[model samples]
Target: MAVAATPSAPIFVVADDHPMVRDALALSLGAAFPGAQVEFAGSLGETLMAVERRPDADLVILDLDMPGMNGMAGLAQLRSSHASVPVAIVSAARSPALMRQAVEMGAAGFIPKFTPSQEITDAIRDILAGAVWLPEVARDHQLAPVEADLALRAAQLTPQQHRVLALMAQGKPNKVIAFEMQITEPTVKSHVTEILRRLGVQSRTQAVIVAQKLGMEPPAAKGS
Candidate 1:
């Protein structure tokens, strides 16, 4: 009998409101796998749009306290819309019950917000390898569960901005991205400026944090 083929390189989408966080994550993922493809979404609406556009994405890195759509609700929405896509929650809210709930709601794993960059990548790699990404805290807290319903709010984004954000998350320079995407460098810079404003960050490094909190890769050294 023939053996099944190994899974392809995983594609990731990060949903967070921090520019430095997103930038950091994009950098980290790029460094980790060299050619791995990664994308970013600053809000719930953008997150949904990304999934719709790239339904075959291997995984999603989600955050808990986004501006409009809370992390839990977004997770549920994603579960409902794309039941097949795997999800991993990366958040600073260290609630055991919530982590368990996320898993029950179809999340493949949970990465604590302060986890090292390498750990984050390791979790993604584990999930991609068909292993669970839950921390020990989650397993222990599963016994005593608290009941809470996190609500999600509505948000919107322009299609053009969404595409620009996706390319930016791939670690492309403005000029190169503009050329490849058929837009002017000035336009690309404007989109990036708008991204920082909407995400409420001053620098790209800060955006990376937000991205990592959302489960996206960070720009720092793998273990640093």
Candidate 2:
């Protein structure tokens, strides 16, 4: 099903690595909206693919701990790539703090894994209606300045820059990063330069430091 262009039917991409969790979310979306179409992806990679297939996706329910997505990077990636879609995080470890950060990074909502099916539906509906749906408690906790800055910086890195930064964090040189990323050395150098510039760092070490501190690993950043 395509992401909705009209309210008559909406499409939701529910991303989680766990099969059971995916099934549960699909069921919840199905039950909540009789005509809604829900698709499932086991990880952030799959989620991105699904979004590519349906760039007009109405909403996305993402797993916070899905493989390849750490901290706020996955949320950032999705928000940046699919700016029109309203995305939300669904996690077993939901918290007021994380929710605030997700919202600050551009999430449309935050749905706790423990949220009842009814509330989940309500939250999704609210977001689709152009409202920011978040837990009441999350409104009280704002990210510290450093964390906010980190989240913003991570969000700024493109997928290739993220990959280069990740390898650099492990102390890999340009040659190794190019090999691992299956790109040319010059491309790797370009990525490194962009990474440093985006992270506001003067050098590789500083870029890695900033990336790791900001949790900049996206699923595709594992190299080409």
Candidate 3:
């Protein structure tokens, strides 16, 4: 396999809610890139803020089910806000479908949480060297056309529109969305309208279904 040029002492941001997972990733990253700096975040909001603070971060390893992630929507949000930074999804859910979806949504890599430490380090190395990494099991898995189309439509949403869509998926009404987003009710309604139009869905319920399609509902057997 071809490897991109590697950066020495690269900065990495590891975002996962579980302290143990964060520490394990930190250990792997620190060992792999000696003198590297590793930052931690327990939620999507924090991850975005952390990345915003360090736009030059070489890589970001994110947890899909973390607080404020709203599934792949958070990935879309991060990609939209900081398209330059390479973000990898490191999660317990290892379904090939979810892995393909993450890549479809622009992840640099999808590392299953149970990955061995040395392999994790190697994957991070590959990602830093400008390669897209995925578990061996996901290599030959093809994304369904409908799944790919959903990813494409989801990617079309502006970051704010993504936030509105996430709230709508949670069954939040426009008034509540307005209060949470600190915007006027009419603004929220406008966002909802745009979300519906962008997703090619006519009604809020249909939009919610689209959101759920991009949501974090991995199989019950796939523990998050």
Candidate 4:
């Protein structure tokens, strides 16, 4: 779905430690939405400063593992300081616990660090439309309350893809996943690719993030 345009362009804030990653994300957003404005922050201090300077950001894409101030802590602070601005967790950690924590902490959605550009755009659009972007399992398990449509959409994933997603969320590499599942490395690679496609993510980190948002646990090793 396309993001609805407003008379005033929506402002965005992105906080991440890696300069290249931050720039890449900004570039991707710029390409996707030509008129929108984005502000970058490399640390929590910088993020706070940017927010103070421009208290009109419509969305904040937050990284939860930054130096000095952890992502969750920063998020809490941001919420306290700017209660109205919506926040989205965009992190590398894919643990279900973390994703649950993000929602409980009042994030509008949880977007994985490796999510594809299109998925990221979709998430932003959805959030702006006042819809939460959580996975179906998370809703079913009561990890978070979500829209029925989001839950139904998540339920469409295949069982094998679900297993693959669970393993990836546990930080398992493709080779380790292959060995544990008794599948060939190439097969694992293919599954990983398919999982990313299904999740609308561009990288493993993003896929793992999405898996956690769905309330998925790590897959058991082949022999337990």
Candidate 5:
């Protein structure tokens, strides 16, 4: 029988806006996965770019509340663009519902920001070994069919369209989205039309409702 090969030094991207949290996780990862290559990002855009630059990275530890995330929308974008790279959610939110939702959305693991460094390391190791990791609080979870379908649709969006839809989900008008995204209003309108089509929704209201399925109010966490 042949033995499978494993990476001797794993590469990781830790994406969090807070410098302290990002540094702390890097330290923990370095200690746990000796000789591991760790990169950092402060927002969803930066995270996406970093992962794009390192598509062969072993893992991505993502922060759910960072800028440009707009809830789990960014996750959909990342998974859409880089299906081969594994992603893990590390958030302050300890909600079992959110954890289960992440798993259903194709996350490799869900780690609470408050989890001890050792546990986080263990979770990473397990995920890298091809196991799905979720906290104990989220063990017996199930997903609604509607939510699963929504995640699937969201993952089909192109990166730019996903960003437009995220802003739209915030109830932003086309002009506002254009200004925020530094694009023209007409372009925003085009994106909206395509977003509605991809989501199989005929109107902006229905599209927002679909976005809301993956939406979340930011959670407050200590030391995060």
Candidate 6:
């Protein structure tokens, strides 16, 4: 019988826009992997940078609602760019169907935000061991078929397109998105066109509705 091999310098990354969440994940992972190197990224861009900086990373756990990710689009980008590195979704959304979709889309696992720290550490270990980590009962948790369909549609978008869609979901005007993204209005318009086309919706409201159903929502104002 062959023994399992653990990473000699495992680099586990926890990507989330929320600072506290990132810190918590880091603490749990640090304890679980002991000598493992853990990195923290706040957005998809940072996550990609982390990937570039730590090519030897063994696993990446990301929040689906993080900035610039546009949901599962970030997951697809990571998998496509770094096929050798395993990725997982750690988000507030807790739908079994979404978890299934993420695994189907190439994620090593789906870890919901509510998961206890101990369980999360265990999940990270299992994924590092080359096993799929999922809630035992989520395998049977029923979801509307539309959720899975939307998730697949979401996977088809480019990373930039996903960011555009995210801004639209926040009800940000094109000018605002342009200013925030530092792109020309025309470029933003182009992204919107593709976002609408890929989402199979004619307008932004409808597009936002689709994402909301998938548990994608803009966090309330800082003090709200």
Q: Global lDDT of each model?
A: 0.64, 0.72, 0.79, 0.67, 0.80, 0.77
lDDT of 5 by residue, 1-224 (tens): 01122468888989999898988988888788777888899998899889888887889999988888866767877887888999999987755655766776689999998898899999999999999999877766455556656656765676678778778877789999899989999999999999899889999999877766655433446355
TM-score of each: 0.60, 0.69, 0.79, 0.58, 0.72, 0.78
Q: Which of the two candidates, 2 or 3, achieves a greater lDDT against the reference?
A: 3
Ordered list by TM-score, greatest first: 3, 6, 5, 2, 1, 4
lDDT of 6 by residue, 1-224 (tens): 01123567477777888888877777776677767677888888899988898787889888887776766667777887888888988877766656766787788998887888898888888888899987763453554566657767776777677667777877899999999879999999999888888878898789889766655567545445
CA lDDT, candidate 2, residue 5: 32
Off by over 4 Å in 1: 1-8, 141-224
Give me the displacement of residue 31 in model 1, in angstroms.
2.0
Tens-place lDDT per residue, model 2, 1-224, is 33333468788888888888888777777777777877778888898999888776788888867676654656667777788877888876544555655776688888787888888888888888999987765654555666556556665666566556666766788898788768999999887777777667798777766755544333333224
Best-to-worst lDDT order: 5, 3, 6, 2, 4, 1
Alpha-carbon lDDT of model 5: 0.80
Tell me the deviation in Å of residue 205 in model 6. Answer: 1.8
What does candidate 4 score in Cα RMSD to the true structure?
Answer: 14.6
Count the clashes in each prediction. Answer: 22, 0, 0, 3, 0, 0
- How many angstroms is residue 165 displaced in model 5 relative to the true structure, after the best TM-score fit? 1.8
* Model 6 superposed RMSD (Cα): 4.8
Q: Please list the residue runs of candidate 6 whose C-alpha ends up more than 4 Å from where it truly belongs after superposition.
A: 1-9, 17-20, 43-45, 64-83, 95-105, 136-141, 221-224
User: What's the alpha carbon RMSD for model 2?
Assistant: 5.2
lDDT of 3 by residue, 26-114 (tens): 87776678777878899999999899887888899999888887677688889988989999888877556567667866889999888
* Prediction 3 global C-alpha lDDT: 0.79
Distance from true position, residue 49, model 6, in Å?
A: 3.0
For 59-125, candidate 1 gives per-residue lDDT tens digits of 8888765643433546666777888888888877675555665676678888887999998888878
lDDT of 4 by residue, 1-224 (tens): 12334556677888887788788877777776666788888787787887887687888888866653433445667766787888887876655445655576578988877777788887778887898876443443654443332333333444455456666777788888788768898988888888677556689887766655554444233234
